[model samples]
Target: MLLERDNRLEQPDSFYAGLIAAHDGLSLEQSADLNFRLLLILANQIGRHDVLQAAIAAAREGVTA
Candidate 1:
C-alpha cells in the first residue's frame, strides 16, 4: 500500500513538471504550505489507516540525527 493513489498521477511526467511549476517563485513557507495541503488531500484520499500508518513508518524508517 503505497502512500499514494492507486491511479497515482496521470501522466506522471507532466504532473511532475506541473508540481515544479507550481513551486516556482514561491517562498519557502508558501512551498511548505502547498506541500502540507497536498499531503492532507492525498492522505485523505488514501483513506486506509493501516496503510497510512505503515507508509508513515516507512517514510521515517531512517530519520535520525
Candidate 2:
C-alpha cells in the first residue's frame, strides 16, 4: 500500500507505524478494512484530500513508476 501514499512515500516509518497499530490483532480482511477506515480518518484529520487523491491516482498510474 505504499502506492497509496504518493509523494508521502518518504514517510514510510509513520505509515507502517499506523498500519501496525491498525492491524496488530486482525485477520487479512479485517486488517484491510480497518486500515482503509483509519486512512480515511487520518486524511480527513490532516486536511490532506489532494494528497490522498494523488496517491490513488498514482496507484492506478502504475506499480513501477
- TM-score to true structure, per model: 0.76, 0.51
- Candidate 2 per-residue C-alpha lDDT over 5-65 given as tens digits, one digit per residue, 9 for 90 to 100: 3465667899778768867879999978886898688778767667677776776778764
Q: Write the per-residue lDDT of candidate 1 for residues 1-65, one digit (tens) a residue.
A: 45554665669899899989989999999999999999899889888989988888977887874
Q: Cα RMSD for candidate 1? A: 3.0
Clash number for every model? Answer: 0, 0
Model 2: CA > 4 A from native: 1-15, 63-65
The C-alpha local distance difference test score for the whole of candidate 1 amounts to 0.85
Candidate 1: which stretches are off by over 4 Å? Answer: 1-9
Candidate 1 lDDT score at position 17 = 94
